[model samples]
Every structure is written in C-alpha cells, then in structure tokens.
Target: MNATDRTLAGLLSAALSDDPSRPLVTYYDDATGERVELSVTTFDNWVAKTANLLQDELSAEPGDRLALLLPAHWQTAVWVLACASVGVVTDLTGDPSAADLVVSGPDTLDAARSCPGERVALSLRPLGGRFPQPPEGFTDYAVEVPGQGDRFVPYAPVDPDAPALALPDGSELTGAQAVERARQDAAARGLEPGSRLLSALPYDGWEGLSAGLLAPLAAGGSVVLAPRLERLDAASLEQRVENERVTHTAA
Candidate 1:
C-alpha cells in the first residue's frame, strides 16, 4: 500500500497477508508466569472476529465510545486493533460508565458495574485467569453475540476527519490527525517504512498507541509490545533499544 493508503489496520492486514506466521507480540504473563507468543495471523483473526462482534453484536457505530479496563497485554492488542478496524472509538481509561461498552478485568468489573450509565458492558477475562464471577447485572464478554460472523464484514471506511478516539478527559481526536501524528513521529525518528520497533509501554494511552504501535505499523514496520517494562528506568530502556536494534524508542 502507498503511504497515503497506509493505516494501523491496513498495515497489519498487509503484514499478515505477506507473512501470516510472523510474530507480532511476544511477552511473559505474570498471572500464568509463562512466556507467550502471538503471531500476526492469529492476532489478525482475533481483531477480525472481535471487530465483527463490535459492529454486529454490540451495534457499535464508527464513532461510538468503547472502553477497556484490563491490564496491558495481548488481549489489549486485539481489542485495540478491533476498535481501529471497525472505527469504534476506544477509551482506554478505567472509567467504564463513561462508555457505550467496556472490557474489564475481574477485579474491576464490580466497581465498573456500580455505575449504570453504560449502554452495554462486557467483563474482559484475561488469558490464563479463571473466568471470574461477573459483577451482578453484568454480562460475560465471551458469549458470541448473535449475527456475529466468523470473519469480519469490513466496516465502512470512516471519514478521515471524524473523531476516532476519545481521551480520558473526554477530548477527541480525528482520524486524520492520528494518522498524521503516527507518520510524523516515525519520520522524525528516522524510522520510516520497514523499520522495527520494540515498545516497553502499555497500549492504554496515546503514546503507546500512536508512537509505539500505530506509527511503526503505518510505516510498514512492526512493534513488539512489552507492557511491564514501563516500570523500567532509563538504563533498562536503553538496554532494550540496543538489544532489539529499535530505531525508535519512546516512553
């Protein structure tokens, strides 16, 4: 795809098309205390299936607010991409009541349910964890939504000028601006298309989404997400950068 046509979703689709078996994100889970590797093709499938569910089952519109309250991990990766694919506005902040739908962990699901302002809510069970009891009056996120296809029925292309995401403070950002920022950041770091990125941050914020993942994907590069590394100091960050040969490393 040309630079003009590149997007986070588009680049991921292209990468999987060329090398479905390529590794996307690899990390260890503290809950299971085990190492896990997620491939591009598998990750794409999760994104596709979840995107279809978001559009068909949840009836999410292109700009509808969707919140996530889980820990930063592969599931976060899937939901983030699903939101991008279907044009659902992802709200990463833990406040579930402020959203049309929410994906949250077992611990926070009860507190999330106490506020009844949400249109629909889904409790997100992290991988390797027991399906925790959903708070009263809440729904399990795993139930297949009716009419959700096995594959995604690509959502209509969103208006580039329309707001694609909402910040914790309720501020919004346009799709065009998000794309432009990703491109610009990659260019500034001399990490254009084909560069590789290794990020030690969570996708729960703009820095992780734009600079760490989307920017690299938009530029025909790849990102390896290492969530807990955020607690690392500057020395650790530099060590990772050198070992990974990461062209662009951001906090």
Candidate 2:
C-alpha cells in the first residue's frame, strides 16, 4: 500500500493502477460447485455501480449506518467497498432496527424488515441474478445495481478519520484505522505483492474481513474465498489450493 493511502478507496485505486486485469477476488462455493473470479477492473466497476445505488437511489450519506446481513461471498465484498466509497458506515451483525438502511440476503429478509429505511436484497446467485419474486418492502440489489451508472461520485468526500466500520462487539474503526490494520495484518501473515491467499473464514468480524478482503487489497495480492468451506473434502480443498496457486491460508 502507498504511504498516502489512508482509506479503502485509496488502497483500491492504487491496486487498480498497478494492475487492472489481475484477479482481485476469486470466490468459490464448494456446496454449489460454483466459482467466480473478479479482476481489479471488474471489481471496481461493480463497486462503482453499487456505490451509485447507495448514493443516488438510496440517498445514503456519510455516517449513516447500514446493517449488512450477508455471507462471505463476492457480492458481500462488493458491498463493503461500496459502503466505503460512499462514506456509509457498515455494521456487520448489527440490529436491523438501529440501522438507517438494511441489506440482507435470501436467508435474512425477515430479520432485515425491522429497519425502516430503504431495504435491499441480494440473491447471491451466479452472475448477480435477481430474486425469482421480489420480496415485499425490499428492492432487489442485483436488479437495481445494473441500471446505475458505471461511475460513482460521492456527494461529499469521505473523511479518513470518520468511522467506517461498526463491529459486532460494538467497536468502530475509522477509515484510516481500518486501512492501517489491514496492512499490519497482511505483513503479519507474510502476504506480499502478487501473493495469493486462500481464505475459509466467515465475514462476520475483522479476522474474516482482513484475511478475505482487506489484507489482500492492502498487500496488492489476491484472495481466494471458499465459503461453506466445511463442505469441501480434504482432497477437494487440496485441489483448490493447487488450482488457485494459493501461497497463504487463512481458515
């Protein structure tokens, strides 16, 4: 990461500049036998569209709390960066009633209805498919995001010192702090530029966020996320490691 990169957006910009075509997130769902890989450029485009959806459609602003109820998936990673870009503070495992907005996946729609603000649902399907039937009181993220502009411009600049993440333990981290911690974790894990880290961690806390997303972004490396990892047999896991050319492991 660059000395001046204090926010997730800055870190992503640096990565895009370094290599736009390199794979940044390689996601695998062993239970479904599904795999999806997103290059830096593609990932940025998804982030841009989602950011636009948050800023323009949802009218989400800086410091607004968004309850993010999703699993360790590629689209979840997109939402993380999208919230950062628009200065929306993401709450992982937060109560829906306390949030200004709520994003839930197929399994959490009922719980997410407590939020009075704009609600969005993700199908979490391959290629970002929409729900077969749109849930009541919630907009489909995959349906809404595609029509948004490819570029995103926040209404106000994000402050590096402003709180960006609200943890399950009720702790918060500013944008700068999160970036710094990601870099620190990357170094501690021996992650370097061009390294490939395979992760089988849930996205409910900092450990998973760092290993599955931020650490790779901080180190200019890539991540191979294996969600529902327990379902993968030992032989399948080994084959995945070999196929993805994984240099590091975080389980």
Candidate 3:
C-alpha cells in the first residue's frame, strides 16, 4: 500500500484485497452476553450496504456531518467505517443539533429526536435489531440498512483532506490524517500481520479510536473489542485473551 493512500476508505479497500477472509472485528459485551465476529469480507459487505443506505436513503453527501451516539459494539464500528466510506464526518457525541444527521443508540432515542435534520436509530441489539414497534420519526437502521444494495460508489469522490472524525473535546482529523495516525499507533502498539488485539477501550477519543478500530485495521491485525470491560471478572478476561490468541492489548 502506498503511504499516500491514507484515506480511510482506501485503507479498508486495501485490507479487503490483501486478506479478505481474515477476521477483522470480534466484539464482546459481557454485560449483555453479546459475542459477534466479522471477517474482512463480511465487514466490507456491511460497510458497502451501510454506505449505500447513507447515500440512497439518508442522502448523506460527502460533507454531511453525523453525530454518532452509540457504544463500542460491532455495528457501531460498522457505522464508523460506513461514514468514512462515503466521506461523512463522524462526531462521537450525542449532540445531534450540531450535525446534519444523528445516529442514536437505544439509550439516546429521546435526545436524538431533537435533531432538526434526519435521524437514524440503531437498537444495538444482537444481530442488529430494529425497535420492537419502531420509533415515531426515526428510521430504524437495522430494519432498513440490510435492504440497501450491497455495492456503493459515492456520488462524488471523497477528498483525503476532508474532515472525517470529531472527538468529544472538539478536536477533529481529516481522513488522511486519521489513517496516518492509525498506522503510527499500530506500530507503537506492536501490532503486526494477523495479530489479535484484545482491547477494553471505549470508542471515545484518539486512544479508543486507535486501539478499538483503526490500529488493528492499519496493521493487518484484528481487534477483540470488549465493551463494558468492567463487567468481565479477572478470570473471564484472562480466558478471553487465551481464547482469542491476543498478541497485543489496550485496557
């Protein structure tokens, strides 16, 4: 891969071509007893569909800003990459009024509805479920995303220099910057090809973004994201490390 091919989508495409069958994300939520695994091929497929959903159903243009109100789960990671795929700026916050679109999780339904523009809600349930009865005005993501086409070609090409991530403290990184930083962090974290990293970091800021999402992808490794980490007892956590063959960790 070229050093300058630093766009998030470009990096993901490279991963897909390099080793599509490799596992990419393994999610565990001991609190909810959720275990979800995704291979590179599977992840790419979901990203394509979600990108298509964003572009076709939500009209998420390249410059669109999306405030993501979700946890560190498998599908949330999908949304992050999906936003990057189509050049949507992802804000890791619950403040929807500041964004063009707000992706609210199960806990933020009421606050998310205050957004003036479009709204999408994810149940964050296992297998990505829709609300039992559906929300009043928001589109249920799990219900609608799967029906979208499996391919996505953005209406306009994404600029590598365009902003892609928004942190809680108002810091932001462009697509190229985020990718480059991830590469550097991956090296620093001793990640290598096929390394399995067990991480108990929340997807809140740079550290979380690096460990939980980007570093693994950047280094041709995979992440075992353990959300609600405190819920896992010492023995359970240790057992997970051995089970996943974890080579690196960030807790």
Worst 10 residues of 2 by lDDT: 1-10
Please provide TM-scores, in order, for all candidate models, with all chains considered together.
0.76, 0.98, 0.96
Q: What's model 1's TM-score?
A: 0.76
Best by lDDT: 2
Off by over 4 Å in 3: 1-4
Q: Candidate 2 residues 88-198, lDDT tens each?
A: 999997899999999999999999999989999999888788999999999999889989998888888898889999999889999999999999999999999999999
Task: List the RMSD of every prediction in angstroms.
Answer: 4.1, 1.4, 1.4
lDDT of 3 at 156: 83
Looking at model 3, the pairs that clash are none
Task: Write the number of the candidate with greater TM-score, choosing between 1 and 2.
Answer: 2
List of clashing residue pairs for candidate 2: none
The reply for model 1, stretches above 4 Å from the true place, is: 1-7, 30-32, 114-135, 142-150, 192-194, 230-248
Backbone clash count, each prediction separately = 0, 0, 0
Question: How much is the lDDT of residue 96 in candidate 2?
Answer: 92
Tens digits of per-residue lDDT, candidate 1, 38-147, equal 67777787788778877876677787777777655666777777887877777777466667777666656665674444433344334433344534565555555333
Candidate 2 ranges beyond 4 A from true positions: 1-4
| Position 217, candidate 3: lDDT | 94
Error of 2 at 10 (Å): 1.2
